[model samples]
Structure formats: structure tokens, C-alpha cells
Target: MPKRVDHEDRRRQIAAAVRRIAADRGLEGVSLNEVAAEAGISKGFVQHYFASRDDMLRFAATTLRGGIEERIATPLRVRDLLVALLPLDDAGRDDALVANAFLVRALKDPEIAGHFRTGHGLLRDAVAALIAAAQADGDLAQSVDPAAEAGLLLALVAGLGDAVLLGYQTGDEAIALIDLHLSRIAA
Candidate 1:
């Protein structure tokens, strides 16, 4: 009998390799040869999964986005949810690095840009739902607009991650800023 291949699992393995490479060497470092080596697969196998670098990048971005959503899915307060979005620890730092690499590349690639834009929309919607839940639970000011606040919060978190990556701020400092923002909106 032939060995059954878990295509999704293999894809995730490849994407993990992509993330590691992007985190270590930025988007420019990602290539079929490198990802294959990192994944312990052949370059032909990598090509079998992704037709081009852009396709690999799109998959990697989707993988990263799915991870963030999964992490924040647990029941948590609005403040905690906001904090969860920060690149405060090792895993968070890696995710942020990969995200930044993708963002930069997205600026030059329309397909990648569309993928990110769609992911951001989904993230914003999720955040807005969390904000609405907080308001309903009396944990946040009822006057706040969930959709608008969600957009602002996402922007703030993204900016803070950039700052952390650029050495302009520490993760602790970024968390402190987020805490302050949360305090201001408290019910």
C-alpha cells in the first residue's frame, strides 16, 4: 500500500519553515530552496505545494493570521485580547517578525496585499465583536463604537509591533501603552 500523505499537514510544515526563515532573515530570505531545506524536503516538493514565491508568501500570511485568531479565540477580557495581539514573548516576537516581512512585501505585490487586506478585515471584525461583547457585559463604555475602536486598536498594535522590531520600544513598554489605552476606555 502507498503511504497516505496529509496534504494540509505537509502544507503547514512548509509554512512553518517559511515563518522560521522570514523571522530569521526577513522576506527576502524566503525561497523554495531554503524553505525546502528548512522543511527537510526537496525543492521539487516545495514547488509541488506552491507554484511561485508569491503563492508561498500568501500561504504563510494566511497561516500567521490563522494563528493569531486561534490565540485570541479563548474567552478573555477586552484588555487581555488587546494585550494578546502584542509581540511580547518569543512566539509573539516571531509572529510579528513574519508579519512585518509579509507586510513589506505586500506593498509591492497586489495579490499579497489583497490577502493581507482580507485578513485584516477579518481581524478587525473579530476585534469589533470583542468590543461589543465588552460593552454588553458592562466592562467597556457603551458610547464607544466597536467597529471604529477595533480599527484604532489594530492600528495601535501594529504600530507598536513595528516599534518593537525597530528597537524604538521594548515589549514591556508596548504592553504598558496598551494598558493605558485600555484603562482610558474602561467602564
Candidate 2:
């Protein structure tokens, strides 16, 4: 019998390869040939999984977002949830690099922009919900607007990631900035 091919797993593998490339060389390094080589698969196999580079990038971006969502899915303190979004470790750094690449491309590609915008919206909404929960739990200042605070939090996280990527700040420093923000807002 022919070997059973798990399509989802194979797709994830290919996406992972793209992410590795993105981490090492930014968005410019993500090509079918590069991904195939990184994945130890044929270029044809990579093409079989993704019709084009953009498709592969979209898949990779979605995968990165899914990983973040999974991590924050469980109930946690709002501070912890925000910390989980930072690029404090290798995996998080890689995710941030890939995400940053896509975000830069989004400036030129409307479709890519839409995908990122949607993802950011989802994150913002989730953060807003968490803020509301924290307020209800008396852990955060009830006078703060959850939606506005969520937007600020998202902006700060994104800015911090950029700062870290650009060497303007270390990962630890970025996390500290976030921690400081949380402390100032604590009830």
C-alpha cells in the first residue's frame, strides 16, 4: 500500500520551513526552492503544498497566529496573557520575525494587509475581553476602557517587537517595558 500522507502535517512542515527561512533571512528568503531545501523536500513537493510564495506566507502567518491563540486560550491573568504575546524566547522571536515580515509586505499587498488586519482585530478583541475580565475580577482599574486599553496594549506589543527586532531594545528590556505598563495599570 502507498504510504499514508497526512496532508495537514505535511502542510505544517512546509510552513515551518518557511518560518525558519523567515527567521533567518526575513521575508526575502522565503521562496519555494528555499523552503523545499529547508524542509528537505523537493521543490515540486513544496509547490504541491503551496501554489505560490504568497500562499505559503499566508499559511505561515496563519499558523503563527494560531499558535499564539492556542497559548492564550486558557484563562490567565491579563498581564500573563500580554507577556505570552511578547518575543521573549527563541520561538517567540521567530514568530515575531515572521509576523514582522508579513506586516511589512502588507503595506504593499492589499490582500496581505487584510489578512494581518483581521488577525490584529482578533487579537485586539481577545485582549479587550481579557481586560474586561480583569476589571471584573478587581485586578485592573475599573475606570479604564477595555477596548482602548486593548488597542494600546496591542500597539505597545507591536512597537516593542519592532524595537527588539531593530536592536533598539533587548527582549528582556521589551518585556520589562510591558511589565512596567502592567504595573502602572494594576488596581
Per-residue CA lDDT of candidate 2, range 53-72, in tens? 88888777767676677667
The per-residue C-alpha lDDT of model 2 at residue 181 equals 93
lDDT of 1 by residue, 5-32 (tens): 9998999999999999999999889999
* Candidate achieving the largest lDDT: 1
**Stretches of model 2 off by over 4 angstroms after superposition:** none
Candidate 1 lDDT at 45 equals 98
Q: Once model 1 is optimally superposed onto the true structure by TM-score, how far is the C-alpha of residue 169 displaced, in angstroms?
A: 2.1
How big is the positional error of residue 39 in model 2, measured in Å on the Cα after superposition?
Answer: 0.9
**Model 1: ten consecutive residues of lowest lDDT:** 70-79
lDDT of 2 at 14: 92
Screening candidate 1 with a backbone cut-off below 3 angstroms (N, C-alpha, C), the clashing residue pairs are none
C-alpha TM-score for every candidate:
0.91, 0.89
Model 1 ranges with Cα > 4 A deviation: none
| Each model's total of backbone clashes | 0, 0
> What's model 1's lDDT at 171?
79
